[model samples]
Target: MFQFLRKVLMIELAGLNRFLLGQDLDLNIINSEVSRCNNNILADLTNDVLSVKSKFADYINIKLGKKKQGEKT
Candidate 1:
């Protein structure tokens, strides 16, 4: 699933790159859509990483009780 998503993203990026290099395509529309898609992808990835980190931290604190000194949970 992840690989397929990555592949699609890569293909879209490549298409944008080709357009930038003077490919025979509608440059204005491609530029706008590609920029939007890239931004959305980046935001989603950032959110996913932060969520995973938070979950891991919770697991560690609950299972191992490795809270730092002077920290309250």
Candidate 2:
């Protein structure tokens, strides 16, 4: 289901976030593996940040009354 996939994606992303923060920018095989499992529900997992972006945008706009110079959210 969507919820289960989202939970798995979140766990994967937590690990991925650590790798990225540690400067381990090499997700080649990982990318391929995930792509191989892609589906509509899985695709939503990838757009997770956009959800965060929309939330952040609303929060920032409400607080600042406008978008910042180059802010995405």
51: Cα error in model 2, Å: 0.9
Model 2 has an lDDT value of: 0.64
- Candidate 1 structure quality by residue, lDDT tens digits, 1-73: 4566668768877876676657565778667777887788768866876787799889988766655533654
Which tens-of-lDDT digit does each residue in 6-72 have in candidate 2? 7887787667555555664457755654455445435676587578778888898887765553475
lDDT of 1: 0.73
Q: Root-mean-square deviation of each candidate, in angstroms?
A: 7.0, 13.8
* TM-scores of the models, in the order given: 0.56, 0.34
User: What residue pairs are clashing in model 1?
Assistant: none
Error of 2 at 43 (Å): 1.6
* lDDT at residue 35 of model 2 (Cα atoms): 52
What TM-score should be assigned to candidate 1? 0.56
